[model samples]
Target chain A: MSRSVKKDTLLKVAESLFYEHGFRGVGLKQIINEANVATMTLYNHFSSKENLIEEVLKQREERYWSYLDAHVEMESDSPFILAAEAHGRFLKEESYKGCMFLRAIEDYGEMDNNIEKIARGHKQKLLEYFQQLAHRKGKNNEKDLANQFTLLLEGTTSMTPLIGAEKATEYSIAMARTLVQHTS
Target chain B: MSRSVKKDTLLKVAESLFYEHGFRGVGLKQIINEANVATMTLYNHFSSKENLIEEVLKQREERYWSYLDAHVEMESDSPFILAAEAHGRFLKEESYKGCMFLRAIEDYGEMDNNIEKIARGHKQKLLEYFQQLAHRKGKNNEKDLANQFTLLLEGTTSMTPLIGAEKATEYSIAMARTLVQHTS
Candidate 1:
């Protein structure tokens, strides 16, 4: 395989493993073996496991937004419900591992600055998207409504694995509707 | 030292390490080394690392309730606000290690049934407390109010390390107030 194809294979395999088991749970050897790439090839592509993790995170961010983009059609409906519906659908997908950013924060927040930055950045960007939706909807206080909706979204994400994703998303969608009604 | 004292020391040391790193991040050897206890002594107290982890979680549950009890006087004010305030205070404390239960769920939710049970039980109990308080406050839809408040509380817990506990708590408290007023 070419260098770029090998690198993509590494990212794809490692991302699956990292999502299934946490960052600390999976090691470089496991990733290399699973990716079917030689150890030297792995090292040549990424300087270190940490660098590979950062790349995985960057790729995950792209994947997540891409997933959201496919589900959300901006021209069709209210941005608020459209965004909520998109997330609710995303939560139920077969490949839906829980929020990778939240997992990253939980796994590496205390130990790794770069991981924490990337994870926090993902959350901030999502919050900004919600703020944009809230503003477009013309809520009296867009920021406050955005904050509440974001909390509901975060709560649903954190609770899904325990309560099951569909139920959690249902509750979150209902709560979001209530908040939108109250504020709008 | 007495056997019980040795066991307590192991739990304390292990708990700290588990909280800083994750369940998979720390190992039995590290726990024994950090606690300065013999391998035999550690095994005598707990059959395996899994058992030790369960005990640590049980002890953590007790410690968390005790900490909350210290701050919340059921008769002094609205139990809802008081409990939320107690949690907000706990979140700001130096030893605040994110919700141990939440961390446990995130860590072992897939592989370990016992861990998921304990974590889910903790959340259920907190929700019941919120329900009882909502009943006391005479909300028309006490259960719904309780659920909303619980979501805010859970969201605050999950987001604290990223957003800073104080800000997270402030948002939760404000949202809780809004929910309470709406339902009352």
Candidate 2:
């Protein structure tokens, strides 16, 4: 396989492992073992494990943003519904492991700088997205709506395991109804 | 110092380190160095690193439950306010590093059994607390309300860094006013 092909393969496996485990928990050996790549091959695609870790998070950021874009299409009248649908769609994804961003932040205690930066950046975009949605929805001081709604989304994802509710997005739907502008 | 003193000292130092850096990031050596004790001192008090980890989580659970008790007493009127206030108090503590249960869960990728128990137990208690509060308030469905409010608390904590507002408790307060019953 081409290096790029192999690299992407490594990243996919790594993302699942890293997400399921965490940054520090999964090491080079495990990544290589899982990827079925030689140790040096793993190093060749990424300079170090840290870089590879960055790639995993970066991959998620791209996918997360893309998911947000495709699924959460908000028109002027339906920003709230857009946000709700976006969260709902996310919940329904085949492999749900709570919020990737929250998991990353919570897991890595002293993570590589690269991983931390990517996590922070992903979170910022979500916050900004919410802000825009609030503005689009004509919320007064939309920042309030944005911040509050962000908590609802974050809360639902983070609390899923604790509540043992298979479909957390349902709660997000109720919360979305509560948050949006109720103009019919 | 006595072994009890050494044990408490180790727990104190380790707790702060784990909170700031993460359980995996801070090794036994670091804890021993910071505690100014020998490796034997650590094992003498707690069976293993994992054991020590559980103890640290245990201490946090105590503080968390105590905090909940005081807040529930003060803001029993509204479930939302009570939940928010508890979280707010959590953020206000001297060594705030978001939720300890969350921190552990994040680090515990595959689960080592013991720590999982700690995380699971705390989460159950948290849900039960919410359920009882919701039941007392006579929400639509006590189970659903309890589950929903637990998500609120969890989600808000996860979003703390993204919001960048040091006083995240304020956001919880605003959310509480909306979600809780009108007791106060």
- State how far residue B102 of model 1 sits from its true place (Å): 2.8
Candidate 2, position B101, lDDT: 74
Chain A of model 1, TM-score against the native?
A: 0.87
Instruction: Report the poorest 10 consecutive residues by lDDT, candidate 1 chain B.
Output: B94-103
The numbered model that scores best in TM-score is: 2
Q: CA lDDT of B10 in candidate 1?
A: 96
lDDT of each: 0.74, 0.71
Report how far off residue B66 is in candidate 2 (Å): 0.9
Poorly placed runs, candidate 2 (over 4 Å): A1-3, A94-96, A106-112, A164-166, A181-184, B1-3, B94-96, B109-112, B164-167, B181-184
Per residue, candidate 1 scores C-alpha lDDT tens digits across B1-184 of 4458999999999888887777887889999999999999999999988888888888888777876788776655557776777788767763334567776766676775787788778878877777777676666676666666666667777667666778777777776665555544
A1-184 in candidate 1: lDDT tens per residue? Answer: 3458889999999988887777887898999998999999999999888788889999978877876788666555456666777777766762344567777776677775788889889888987887777666666676666676776777776666656678777767776665555554
Q: What is the TM-score of chain A in candidate 2?
A: 0.85
Candidate 2 CA-lDDT value: 0.71
List of clashing residue pairs for candidate 2? A154-B155, A155-B155, B80-B180
